[model samples]
Structure formats: C-alpha cells, structure tokens
Target: MYKVDKDLLAIQEARIHIEGAKEAAIELRNFTQEELDVVVNKMAIAIKPHLEELAKQAVEETHYGLCQDKLLKNRFACEYLPQQLANQRYVGVIKENYEQKTVEIGVPIGVIVAMIPATSPVSTTIHNAFIAIKSGNPIIFSPHPRAQKTIQRTVKLLKEAAIVAGLPEDGINYMQLVSSTSTNELMNHEETALTLVTGIPKLLPKLKAANKPFIYGGSGNGPVFIERTCNIQQAIHDIIESRTFDNGIVSAAEQSIVLDGPIVEQAKSELTRQGAHFLSEEEAMKLVNVLMKKNGDLNPESVGCSACELAKKAGIQVLPTTKIFIYEQAYVSENNPFAQELFSPILALFVEPNWQEACEKCIELLMEGAKSHTLVIHSNDEHVIREFSIKKPVARVLVNTPSTLGGMGATTNLFPSMTLGSTSLGIVQASDNISPEHLVRIRKVGYGVRTLNDCFNESGNQSLHSKDTQESIEVILRKIINEMKE
Candidate 1:
C-alpha cells in the first residue's frame, strides 16, 4: 500500500469540499421555489434571536468591532434582509401574460464561495448564507482566520437548520481549516460558480485573476463634505459614531472629514463633545510630516491605526477618552499618506477655504481606492447637496446624517449594509445596499405575435393602473434641472 503524503491529502480534501458544493448546487436547482423559501425562512428564524449573543462571540473571537454595533448589523440581516426576499418571487415563471409568453425565470448559479472578513465575521456569513439560500444555490463560507470560531459556530447552526427544513444536508458548508493555500485554490477552482471576496484592497488583484464572476467589498476611505450650512453639531456626532464604531473597522466607514470654513470651529467643538481630540495646528503639521512621505504617500503603518496610537508611537501622550484622534493639515501633500483607507478611529480633517476646495479634496481621496465606497454631505442647502450628489463619483451619498450610520442605513433610512460598493472601480455598479438579491440572475420568455395580440385585448391597457403621474413628473424635472446646471 502506497503511503499518502499529507500535502496530497490536503489537496484531496479540497477536491472533496469542492465536489460536495457542486453536488449541492445541482440538487438545489431541482428544488421548487416553495422549498427554497422554507429554507430561507428557517435559516432566518434560526439566527434571529441569537444576534446579540453572536455579536458578543464575534467580538471576542475577532477582537474587532463593538458588540453593540455588530448586534445591529446581525439583526438587520436577520429581520430585514429575509423580509426583503420574503414576498419576492425568487423561483417562478413570472408572467405578464402566460398566453402572451412574457415571462421571466430565476436560475441558480451552482456553488458560491463567500469570503468573510475578520471585521464583520458573523454578519457577513449570515448575509451570504441567507442570499445563497434564497437564490437556491449551495454556498461554502471561508472566514478570515481571525474569525474562525464565530464563523464555524454560525455555519454549523445554519447547516443544521437547513437540513431540518428538508434542504440537502450539504446545502451550506464552511472551511473549518482554511488557509491562503486553500483559499487561492478555491477561488481559482473551476467549480466555484460565483465568489464574494471582502478583505484587504490588495486582494482584489488576485480575485480579478480568478476568472470567475465575483462581488468585492468596498474600501473604507469614503470622503464626506460638511458644507457650512450643515448642522455642524449633528454632523460632528454622526461622523464620530461612524468613524469609531467597532473601532473604525467597517470597510464602508468614513475616512476623511472635509470641513467647510464657516463651520470648522463649530464642527470641531461638537466633535470634542463626542470624545474626539483634535490636534493643535502645530502638532497636526508635525504629525503630518512624520506620517506622510515627502512624495505625499501615507505611511503604511498609519493606514488603520488610531491617532492616539500614532501619537503614542511618536513619543507623545494621548488622552484616555479620545474616541477619535485628528490630524490637522493644510491639504494632502505629496509624500503625505492621506489617500489610504485607514480602518481605525483616526480621521484626516482638511479645512477648505470654500465648498469648491472641499469638493476638490474629497475627489482626490475617492480617486485613491474609494471607487465603490461612500461619500457623505451635510447641507440644508438643496443646491449644495444636489450639486455634490450629481458630481461626486462615490456610490452612496448621505444628506444631513452621520456618514457611518447613515450610509449603513441605521440612523437614517438608507438600507443597512456592511459592504459599500464603489461604482468608480466598476466592481460595484450601483449605490444601492448590497443584499442577497444580488446573487440572483433572471431568465426571460418572449411572446409570439398571436399570443401578444390576444393578451393585449384581454388585459386592456393594464399598464395604466399605476397610482399617480407625480413620480414621472419628478423624474422629468430632475433631469431638466441637471441638464440646465451642466
């Protein structure tokens, strides 16, 4: 009997994992929409009540993010996400008219590999699992090493629930023993029908080479402008919560605060009240010199570290209650590292002479890695909000809300999402919240001449049944206004 080398055994194990997923996907394709809905509802119910507990476990395991914030993210997925898909028909011949043959169908894309980040572990898993289940596709979750325990436990519960709901036993799986070697192989594997990767910005280059249809996580370097007319105190509070929640680890969290001249002082005062420590101008300049390269690059170490951490390293004492540490600088200088996405409670505050200057600075940051990230603005002036919303390249734009909570659909009415898409990079083409509905693809059926005519007569202009013409009028007016501005 030939001995089996350990390396060869690992490869074989990966093969088995991939094969199991493939088989599950095929089995899922044979299921009815009713069966898929049962799986969806069952999984949602299974995870709903345990959100708070799971958040605690996640923070303990990953050592990132606040338990309370994670709790909000988890509950959002459990209650809202499923509810969004609840009444929607995922699998069916959606027919405008059966005889006319105007129909659309939902088709499952076999197996998917969802890569969960350490920052938002359990929440990502829950979201991915729910989406996969709703779309009638089998999924394998690959958690970042920092969050293995939490991810493993959740996946275990979800799998069991799916089985109990009469779904295939292997409908959902997890890589209990995941590593770079395994993940690289899994992404490149021919069977991974779709891949959802969320991690370091550097990982995108590798994912791009995988030759598979994938959705990537957005960078956290979102920029926001606080126009002078904005409610300075309210904007400041919102910024603090968004930037510091979970210690600034959310990938979609705001990075830099571009403050308009008139409100800079007021904004700073409000931020101070909310536990933010602003650096004196001299200290800010010194920190900028030390943290930035002569060519304007942000030092690599400063990317995700808090200001207090940076200050301590620079041989200075930082205040204890400093929820956010600030660096005051004239502008992004060459060799200064201001364009990076720092996943911490540090924010770069740039004081602009006017709205034009603020807009320019915000644009520069977005050009760095924020293609699909978020941009926030605070202004009561409709013109300011309108101009910025139309001109800014980032995906989501929040008006009069804190950048973080507002973008996440928390304090404001925006849809809750941990993952923000950057449309600029073409990775995410929209500003809408990232949801499981994204996992589905539609198929359409067309009608023949005779059938079309018969249906038109039977329906008798049913398209005219809409409530009002107000929405259409608004669209036309907005378009006209945008063109006139141009």
Candidate 2:
C-alpha cells in the first residue's frame, strides 16, 4: 500500500478544519454579544491557571524571550484583553446612528486563517482565539513548526473552555499536521474569509498571493527620538525599559535612538547609568556578524537574546548586568545592520544637530525597516510633540512612553492586540490594532436619510461665497499669472 504524501495529508487536514470552522461560524452568528462575551470570559478564566505553564513551555520550546515576560504577556492577553472587550459590542446590532438615520449590524467574516509566530506563540494564540470568538468568527491557527507543541496545548485548553461556555467545538482549531503547504492551503481555502497574520517578512509574499483579504502585522524597527525639550531621565528610562522588554522581541520596541545634540551627553549618561553597554567598533562588527545573515535576514539564534547573552555569543565580555547593547552610528541605510530591527536587546544611537535633523534621521531609520508601524517621541514641548506626531510615517507615535507597552495598549488607550496592522503605507490592509471589530463586517441600515434630488438641490442651494471667495480667486489667479510672466 502506498502512503499519502505528508504535504497532501496536511492539506486535507486543513480543508477538514476549514469546513468545520465554516459551519461553526454560521452557528456563532446566531449568538448574542452577551453570549459571546460569556464564552470569552470563560476562556480567559480557564487559560489563567495555565498561563505560567504555557509561558514556560513556550520558552523551552522556542528558546526565545524570557518566561517571566511571556507570563506577563499571557496574562495581558487572557486578563487585560478580556477586560477591554467587556464593554465593547461585537455582534448583532452594535451601533445605531439616530442622527444619520442608520443602524449598523455586525456580521462575522466567516472562518479566519491565523498564522502564529514562534516568538509569541501562546499569547498570540490566546489573543487571536478570544477576538475571533468574541466577533462570532471561527479561527483555525497555523502554528509555527518550532512552537507547535506549546501552541497546540494552549489551543486545546482554550477550545475546552470555549466549549464548556457554549461555544461550538470546532469554533477554535489548529493544524495538527503542521507544514508550509498546510498553511498555504488554509490561507487559500475557499471557506476562509480573512487571514490574520503576524510574523516575519519572508511569509508576506505568500500571504499576498493567497488572493484573499488579509490583515498583516509586518516588521517594526521603530525609532525613539529624544528632542532637546524632553525630560532626559524619563526619556532614557522609557527607551531602556521598552527596548529591553522581552529581550526586545516586540516589533514596536525601539531599534534606534536619535538624540538631539543639546541633550546627547545627558541622555548618554542616563543610558549608561541604566546599564547600557556601548559597543566598540570591533565588538559592534562582531555582533553584526552574529545577528545578521549574508542575505540580510535576522539570525533566528540571535533573536530575543539578552544583551549579556548576545555579547557572550559574539565573543565579547560584558557586565552581566547589561540591560542593553548600543552601537554609535552617524547614518542610516538598508545595508546598515545596526539600523534594522535586531529583535534583541541591541540599539543603534545617532546624535543629530537639532530636532528637525533628528526627525529626518528617525524617518530615514523607519524607511530602512519600520515603515508605517510605530515611533516614539520624548518631548514635553507641545509644539515639538505635535510636529513629530504629524510628520512621522509611523501609524502610532508614542509620546513619552515605552513603545512596546504603549503600542500594545498596556500603557495607552490603544486597542490591546497581538496582531498590529501596518495599514496601506506598509502595504497592509488595516492600520489599527487587530480587534474583534476587524474580524467582522459592518452592515449599514439606512432609512432614506435624503433623496437623490434632495442632495442635488441642497448642494445647488448652497452659496459658494465665504469670506471674499471672488477676491481670493482673483488674488490666486493674479499670483499665478505674475509667476508665469516672471
């Protein structure tokens, strides 16, 4: 007897799950928002007891990040996330606009195909599952092969909890047979409505080729700019805390630091006092060799490693208390490994002549890696803050806060999410944090607010003149003519 190919078997398994999820999604649509919230709350409660164990498993399996931080991430997802969702309406009649004479109903976007990253397997899985069910959608996760066991275990626990709380057994599922072929099949499946993926850039092309609507969370090499008017101590502390959190595995963590010339010395003193070790030129080159491959991709081994660990690996001795590794540089470019996202407790520092130059440098660093993701500005001056906020290309401009925590909503009002959208600027479909609302379609009910003739007549009745419009037009025309003549 001939055996079936493993890839084919994986594809078949994905199809089976997709069909079941499609059926389950239909059932989920019948559930009220309250019922869905009950299921979510129960799942969160059930997962609470296993948070530490799951974190431990993830660390042991993936060998990335710290278990302590992973535990916090898990709790944030299962606890803080549910709290944030408690008051939000995701299903049925979610919004009614009396003024506009329109009502909005929430409709699930069928089955969701989620691709879990190894760097954040358990928490991401839990977060995705809760949001999917909360929005009346069924999700099937394609767990990273390196993190399959931990992800599967977490999924199993959540599935049990969901079923116990009246959710369909197939509402939450994962690929038992994990492979790239299976993931592709799941993404391209006919039953799949949307794909929510957060991972490295290598998988982006395949996701795009799937020919389905998808929300992608791409790479972030967010830069932190310390303007002259900022609180030097607070700014340095926030950057250190954020960049060292989870050993810098978080995409929104600062990859480079752009300091205003006036505050450079104070910032450096504070950074050094906070346990930042500045690497010498030779040592920096050693780390670059270790952290980056010849093809320009980050080395998986170096990702999520602590500063001391990375230093040891690079054959450089450093104080065991080192919280961050710094490389002083004068420029940003695609070829500069230090300017790219390292995914470790490593930062590149650049000193600029002024805030304007610092802003330009920040933009250059973002362009090199993190476009339309996140940026942080440390400044007390409202004018400078507003200027940076408006000029930066990043989606979220964190103000005087740790980028990792602020971007993830731990320290800000932003939506709590494991998957962050990069928006159209990064060639991603969504720009906001991935939430239950993103997994559903909004159906608008309009009650004849106005007729077509009414719209046309109202527009025609409006007087165009406002504060000397004729004079303004004449001034603009005269200026144009004068410039042409000149």
What tens-digit string does per-residue lDDT give for candidate 1 at 332-425? 6534454466667778888898988788888787766535377888888898788888877777788877676777676676655656555644
Q: Could you tell me which 10 consecutive residues in candidate 2 have the lowest summed lDDT?
A: 455-464
- Top candidate by TM-score: 2
Which pairs in model 2 have colliding backbones?
none
User: Per-residue error at 204 for model 1, in Å?
Assistant: 0.8
C-alpha local distance difference test of each model: 0.74, 0.87
Off by over 4 Å in 2: 1-4, 424-427, 449-486
Give the per-residue lDDT digits (tens) of candidate 2, residues 1-486.
997799999999999999999889889878999999999999998999999999999999999999999999999998999999998997799999899889999998899988899988998999999999999999998899889999999999999999999998899998999988898899888889988888656778887787778888757878898888888888888999999888899887888899899878888999999999999999998988889888877789998899989988899988878999989998887778887777899899999999888889888877774456888999988998888888887778889999999988999999998888784433356877889988888898999876543443455443335445446557878998999999
**Prediction-by-prediction clash tally:** 18, 0
Displacement of residue 185 (Cα, Å) in model 1 is 1.7
Cα lDDT for residue 354, candidate 2: 91
Residue 241 displacement (Å), model 2: 1.0
